[model samples]
Structure formats: structure tokens, C-alpha cells
Target: MASGTGSTEDRSYTERLTRLGGARWKQVLDVQAPYRWNLRRHLGGRTVLDVGCGIGRNLQHLDPSSVGVDHNAESVGLCREAGLRAITTDELESSEEMIPGRFDALLAAHLLEHLPEGAAADVLRPYLRFLAPGARLVFICPQQRGFRSDATHTVYFDDDLLARTMREIGGEVVDQSSFPFPRAAGPWFTYNEFVTVGRLADRR
Candidate 1:
């Protein structure tokens, strides 16, 4: 799955993406999206916090109790418009009451590469507090070619870097691997992802 479908947060992107992933179109695409259905099954009944959830793409397959958070107000509006539960990053940070509860899992799919190393750490630490002890943390970042595809992406993560980043944030790495396909796929949408699965080590 792709991260910010639009690099910038603006109504212009909202207007464009709305047409691109509008109701009718989403209905057809959601069912066909790869890996998400199995991901739903893997999640079982756990509630998830989807960080950087753009336009609620990942929300479609997660549990109904999942809450999506985005920095983009327009994207959050679009998610709410589609009857999905979501909140803005400002709202989430402005008050502790906004978080529904400790989530069983956290998803930051295709998100981390956008920030510098230190900024990424700063952004992730706060979210860890909202996770239940032993909660699973799943991180997906671009590999090589995919990293170059988006001009906004500032960093590239191989397996080691992803593991180190998670460990630095107090996560115990459980699995680290290149996903969906081999590295031959090139880092592009519908192809490669450096997937790291970890668990919060009772930090809360």
C-alpha cells in the first residue's frame, strides 16, 4: 500500500483524491487490494491505530474499532465523510481524551521515510504510549526504487535500519523482512516493502 497519495496536505489534493478513490471506486478496489485481507485476518479482533492513514485506505480492511489519524485535515474529513472513524493529528495531540483507548496494534504503513531520522523518533515515541503492553507495532517503509519514486521521501530504510529505529523507540523486533515479493520487484507501489514487526516492551 502507498503512503500519502498526495505529497502535500491541501484541499486541492483532497478534491483530486476524492475523485480518484471516491465511493464507487473504493468499493471495487478494496476487495482486490493485495495483502490487506490477510492482514485483517491476522489482526483478528484487535483494535488498531493507523498513523498517517491517508483517505482511510488501510482502515477498510482493519477492524471496525480501528481509529485512523492523519496530519492532513482534509484527509481526515474525507475519511469521516465516508463514515470511517478518524481524527486529525492536532486533535490527537491537543488532548488525551481523543484517543479511544490503548490500541492492540499500531500501523505506520509507508510513513517513516518521509521524515529525517530524529524527527521520526520524536513522532513515534508519543504514539507508543497509547499502545497496550505487548501491543504489536508494524512499520512499512520504502526500499530503494520506491524511495526514489516520491520526491517527498527523505530517507530509505533497509531491514537493519528499520530494526534499529524500532529498537530505539523501545520496541522489541519480532520479525524483519522484505515483503509481498522479492527485492527484484523494485520499491514501488504493488511491490516491495521493508516490513518490520515488533512489540512494545511494557513501556506504558
Candidate 2:
């Protein structure tokens, strides 16, 4: 069962994001390093807008010039506490970083799967205007095995699904790849993900 829009924005959802299996132990081991570096490799711009920033896991690894946005206020707060810039959806337009063509890239790590069929397009359309005409857009969605790990995931956004959603948002799909493993590994590896890169079509 998938969570409703409200449930995904709840504090409990944010709480679950913090369940990284003993924070101190995980930090000491730096288990997220490879994945963090993997994500960092995709973003090569000075400024990025990280939608669905979720506790700043991805945001923390991005450049300081990046700004994050999530519907979960608590997650936004936690991001700020960790010295990352983040804001809730409500503060988006008014945010100082919302200037036209303000960002060079946009990121939505593990975000689209949480949205139902048409929601990904709706969610991404508005943000495209804030990005430069040819700014990069990266949508990272979990593969089959990783999808089942979260009850909140509404739909699985595989390569085809992601390409469709990106087209709807006026983006040009440039590439798609299985990160840290081959496509075959997705169904068995919990963290295996599809990294889709798109360029916002020249809206000007």
C-alpha cells in the first residue's frame, strides 16, 4: 500500500529517514560514502535545487551553493541544522534562491517514485522555470528491490516511466544508467537505482 500525500509529508516519514542503522556506527563506518560520491559525480554545477531533499542526505553531499526543498518541514529543519540550505514547498517561490534561471542543475533523488502516475510531471514542471534553459535535471529512482523497502513508494519509475515523466515536463532525456551495479542487480540489491539525466528544454 502506498502512503497518501499527507502521510508522506508527516514527521514520521522524516523519522524513518533517520533510521540509518545506528547513526554513530554508520557515520564512523561512513557507509554512505560511495553512494554520496556517486550522486556528487552527476552534479557538476555551482548551484543546484534539490527537490525532495529528505533530511539532506543528498544535499549534504552537494555544493554549498545548492538549495533543497521538501514537503517535510522537519526534514527541512534538519537540513538547516546540518548547515545545508533547505526550504519547505510553501516557502519555495518566496525563497531567495527562486530567481529565474537561478540554478544550474536540479536533483530529485528517490523522489519521483513517491508520486503517483501523473504527479511527477506536475511536481517537476514548476521547478523547471527556475532552472536555466538548458540546466541539467537528474531523477534518481529506486529499482525493484529497493522500491519494496519503502512503504511510501507509490509507483516504480523505471527507465521508461522516467523518460515519459521527463518528456511531460519538457525535458530531453540524454542518458539513463544503473548506478553502482548493472540492471540485473537491481532486483536483488536494495540500494540499486536508475539514474536518469535530462536537460530542461529551452523554454526561452
Candidate 3:
């Protein structure tokens, strides 16, 4: 199980993102534009909190008002260097960036898979307080091929598992989809993702 400390994972993860940043393919075709568009279309919030935002790739594509947090300090530093608002997990816990309930959306992408099954709720619980009662909850996890592509990924989350995680985090599951391809393509396509969206129920 990943400690979420990002200690052992820091160097490797950052190195990988650094390489992806300069990939020759990206220069030619913006291969990720469709995925970026898919993510942005779902985020209809002024203030977004991106959980486990590695190196702020999403931040660069998301609303500028959004903030990102990663367990890795190195990744956080890179984000800061890029002029994106990002912090480490420890910093976010003490950040004055927003008061409770100030955030309209919470995004956890490619994060849950790093933990074991049934562990998403625990990983996400600490970040929930920052979101508004009716905040949108978006959880994205890698499919089979993508899961296998990373040594750190421990689980492959399907729609049922993702919906369950959303519910555990006080979110009501609204919809889910396989991105850039159909469900059948997940086993073959390394970039396929399971995107689940939910809404937090109003507090009584």
C-alpha cells in the first residue's frame, strides 16, 4: 500500500511527468486535448480543488481559479514554479486558501488506483471539508491497461467501485463514462479512464 507520504514515490513520479512534459508526440498532436476537454466540460465550478494533482498537469488545463495538492513536495514545487497554485498535502491541511465549504468541486484523478480497494474514502476524507455541500465530486481512475502500465497502481476501478467510492465520500452518484473510447476498449487502450461524477448531498 502507498503511504501517501510520497517519499519513495516522489523521484520516480516527478521524473515520469518531466519526461511526458517534453514528449515529442505532444509537440506534434496535443494527444491529450480530448481528455483535457472532457475533464473541463465536467468542471462547472469557479473554485476547484484538485486532489493528487501530480506536477499540476490538470492545473495548466483547468480553470485558473483551481488549486492543486499533491503528496509529493517536488511535484508541488514544480507546480509553484509553473505559477500554478499548488501545495503539498501537509500545506493544504493548514492552508488559508479557502474556508470550509468554499470549494465548488473536488477532483481526484488517477489517485484512487494507487490505494487498495475500499481505500478511496479514507484517502479523500481529509479533503472533503473544503468542498461546499452541493459540490461536484469527480473521481477518475485508470482502466485495466493503464492500471497495469504503472507499478504503483494497485486497483482497477470500474463504474461500480467508483460509484461506491463517491457514495462513501458523501456524494450521490449521478453519471459515469469511459473516456476517449468505449468500455470494450479499456483493456487495449492505455489512456482509457473511468470518469464518475457525483454531487454532495445538502447538509441537514
Candidate 4:
């Protein structure tokens, strides 16, 4: 795990908005990519909490009961327009109140990089209280240098590091993989990306 406290407030208003817009496009394309196969594998019939669900694009891939949460008011409006259950909160800490009830799974895509190096785990710690035994948490983020190009990215986590960190938070790794974009892929392959799945440990 990388060290240093991350703060979205560190960026200027324009910079933050730019990052948000870029992410929206990236997510739209990503949702259609083959890499999303893992998401489908785990999402069926499960109630999901989509953190940072901009425009609720991913919601289209899930069932009607899934819920999305975003901190951006505009994105929240878009989510509603798209017919997703959504709420806008000021920060991750506010999610408990903004959307009540436990979730069977949590899906966070490229959202963890925005948090400070160790902060992602911190934010997820409390969500554990809302998960049932054997519930899963799935997350996707850039690998290595891929995390730096984004100005809003406060940290990076490789497969091993991310898996280890998740274990520390009472989740056990079930899967960890990547997906490279078309441009990044080698002559034979055409994309680069990664997805990880972990199951919450049984407390009793």
C-alpha cells in the first residue's frame, strides 16, 4: 500500500471536474469491455452498493435492486435519470446515512485510487458492518504507473498489495486479475485491466 494522506480538496475545482468527466467516459467504455465478465459472475441476484456510481452506467449491468451512490450532485441526477437507485453524499463517511441497509456486495471501480494510499481500506472498514457473512467486495483500479497519470489519483495498489490490504480489513481474496486497455495491450492482446474479488470473513 502507498503512504500519504489523500485529499480530493487538494485539487482545484476545474481539475476535479476534469477528472470526474474523464472518469465518466472511461467507465462507460469499461462497462462494455470484456473485463466486466467478472462483475457479471458475482452480481446476479445480489444486492450491490456501487460506490461513486457516476451516471449509474454500471447500474445498467446489474439488477433493479442495486443502488448507486455518488458525491457529485450532477452525477446523482444523471443516475436518477438513468433509473437507478441513487443518493448523493458529501463523502464516503456519509454513505451509512444516505443509503441505509446492508448490501450483499460492494463494487468500486477506479474509485479507490482517488483515496489516500491507506484511506481506501479505512473507508471500507465501516462498510464491513453492513455486510453479511460471505458477502463479497469487488474493486478495480489501475496498476503500477497507470495510477499516476490521473491527477485525482492519490494512491496506487498492485494486485498483491491490494489483496493483502483487503485481508487486513477482514476480507479474503477470492480473485485478483487485470485488464490492459487497447492501446496498452501487446501485439497479440488488446486491453489491460484488473478485477479483484474478496469474501468477508465470518465473524462468528
Candidate 5:
């Protein structure tokens, strides 16, 4: 529901990204290969909701029942081609249309930093309503070095800030770590990855 300046431009960029075949697509897959491997190891058999699933790159790592949502129509088409259920929307405008039942797990890789700080919180707020009693939310973003690649990224979070924000948003910080890979280093020295688990408070 949050409006931004570059909807048209974002759609164009997503369209171009969708056309990336051969080596370009391979490069993307290569960059994501390690993360996908890690996710599979940690998140198999869990019903996952992948927000901003670009080109379905993470589909192979998740279970078949997983659902992916993005703002790009082209990306949604590609996800369908890869045999994953996908939905396209303009932005986090309508949670009712995109988010349905409670999910066992949620994945938001490289997505949080793209929105403005307040918008990021808005995007995450609705997901809380749909989570099962003890669902886990896995959030991955560029720690410091990874922030410059896209102009759309509005805010960057380190491990401490990420953990603090997750706790404030009613999720318990269950696990946290740094993602190591060969990439351009940034001020933070490492990209922080977090896995937060949600819990339902027992009635008195």
C-alpha cells in the first residue's frame, strides 16, 4: 500500500532481469547457489512463503507446496515455468490478496533492504497475522557491502539491529550468523543472516 517513485522503472528492471538467460542467469544462480543450499538444509518439508521471489531462484531449495510472491509479472511467469505457485502485485499494498493462511516458515531474502525503513516494517507487519503458532521467518539482506548494488535499497541492517528489530516485531531471535561468500566487502565485514522464530503466548 505504500507508494513509491519508481514503479514503472522497477517493472522495467524486473522485465530485463527476466530476459536474462544463458550466462547472465547462470551468474545469478551461482551467486545464490550457496544460500539455496543452506536454505534447503535448514528448511526442507516446511511450507514456506517466499516474498519477492525473483525469477524463482529459490524454488529448487524449497518444498513443492511453497508459494512465491513478487511484484513482477515476468518473474511470476518464470516461477510458474519452474513449477512454483507465484503471484504478482504492485507493492505491499494488499495483504488480503497475497497473504492467506498461516505458513510454517517465511523467506524474505534480500528484500527488506529494498524498502524504506518504515515501509520495510509495514511489509513485514501483515505477515505476523498469518503465521502459525511457532512459525519461523528467515530474513537475508546485504549487511553493508551488499547495499550499493541497487539504487532501490533504502536501509541496511547489521546483525544487532536486525535482531533488535525482530524482537520488537514479536519474534524471538532463535539463531543468527554471518553469510560468508566471495563478494565485494563492505563496512560491516560480513553480511548478517538471521532466523527468527515466532511463538504464541499462552492464555492465562
Candidate 6:
């Protein structure tokens, strides 16, 4: 859910993302609110790099040292307003002297569905090269119900596809699950997500 300022729809998405975690219903079920405390155990004390971190929703749940990178300037601005650490992907890439090459973990929640087939792989491949050996990479893909709930989503991924993508991109699948609720609840809500965890392979 990175920023894309191409058309009217992308602009609308920015507005929606900015308010996603503010709503009463979204606070209980949205990606940021639900995962805040629950994800701490898995993250341990590592510095996380969150890709496409829109409005810093999930960042609120992560460790204070975590950093977020997004394509949308508005999203990064919103995060800054909330006192969260964030940078545009463009800024990170341009100022190569400032960005870190490695991190303890990487997270992409509700992000991949926006990319086309093979494109998701493309986004993740480079990060794999810089991760600490055996570092963790977690992804949350939408199920059918959640996929249809958003107009921006471009692909669907069940467990099989998620696992396949991880393996193909040089990650070892560690865990896969339907989180916070069952698949049956997906249609009625927007929070249900397919969680997939993978570890970087030993490059040594």
C-alpha cells in the first residue's frame, strides 16, 4: 500500500489509508491495530524495515527503532506527523550514503496484493540480498474476501502461492496461518489476512 499519485483512484486510496486505522471498526480489525501487540513476540528486538508502510499503521505496533519506507509522500508525511520514523523509497534509494544495507527483519503487510504476478518477487528479491543471515521476512496476503474488498488489489494468494513465492525468492517458509479470524469471516470484514513467515537462507 505504498503511495501512487497517478490517478484519482490512487488519491482516493491515500485518503482511505490515512483514515483506515482511525475508524472504530478498523481499529479492531485493520492491519495496524490488530497486529500491534501480537507481532511483538515474533519480532523480538530486531530493527525492522517495513516496505510500503502506508501511514505507519503497522509501525505503531513495531519496536520504536523500526523504520518504514513508502512510495507515497502523503503516507510518509502522515507517519512523520504521528512521530514515527519513515522515508520515501525514492529518498532511501537516492541517498545511498544514508540508508542501511541490512536489517534484522522485513515486513510487508497488505502490500503484495497490489503488485502483479512476478512483480512481488521483484520487489522482495533485492532486500533478500541485504538481510542478515537467517533474518526473518514476514508477509500478509489477503484472502478472497479481503482481496475483493479493495479496488487496488491486483492479485490473490492462498497459502500455496504465498509459500511458492517465498521459496522462489530465496526464502525458507517458516509459518503460514489464517490470522485473527477464520476464512469464513473474511467476506464480512476487511481485517482477515494470510500471514506467511520466511527466513533468509544461509549465504555463507
lDDT of 6 by residue, 1-204 (tens): 222223312456679876655777755665454566556766758778888898887887787878888878888887889998888867876644234446778898878887766688888775665467788888887776678767677778778878988888888999887877877776676668788898878777
Residue 25 error, candidate 4, Å: 11
Stretches of candidate 1 exceeding 4 Å from the true structure: 1-7, 13-32, 93-101, 187-190
Q: Alpha carbon lDDT of residue 176, candidate 6?
A: 84
lDDT of 4 by residue, 20-99 (tens): 54587777775455544656786777888887676665766776777777666776766777677887656545544334
- Rank order by lDDT, top first? 2, 3, 1, 6, 4, 5
Question: Which stretches of candidate 3 lie above 4 Å from their native place?
Answer: 1-8
Candidate 5 segments whose C-alpha is farther than 4 A from its true place: 1-9, 19-31, 90-101, 181-204
lDDT of 2 by residue, 67-141 (tens): 999999999999999999999999987888788898989998989888886788898888887898888889998
TM-score of each: 0.82, 0.92, 0.93, 0.73, 0.75, 0.85
State model 2's lDDT.
Answer: 0.86
The most accurate candidate by lDDT is 2
> Which pairs of residues clash in candidate 4, taking residues 3 or more apart in a chain or in different chains?
178-193, 178-194, 179-192, 179-193, 179-194, 180-191, 180-192, 180-193, 181-192
Where does candidate 5 clash, by residue pair?
1-92, 1-93
Which wins on TM-score, candidate 2 or candidate 6?
A: 2
> Model 5 TM-score?
0.75
lDDT of 3 by residue, 44-129 (tens): 44589999899887878878888998888888898999999998888875787856887889999888888766778998988878
Could you tell me how far off, in angstroms, the CA of residue 15 lies in candidate 6 after the best superposition?
A: 1.2
Each candidate: what lDDT? 0.75, 0.86, 0.84, 0.67, 0.64, 0.75
Worst 10 residues of 6 by lDDT: 1-10
Candidate 6 ranges with C-alpha deviation above 4 Å: 1-10, 25-33, 95-101
How many residue pairs clash in each candidate at the backbone level? 1, 0, 0, 9, 2, 0
- Give the TM-score (vs. native) of candidate 1: 0.82
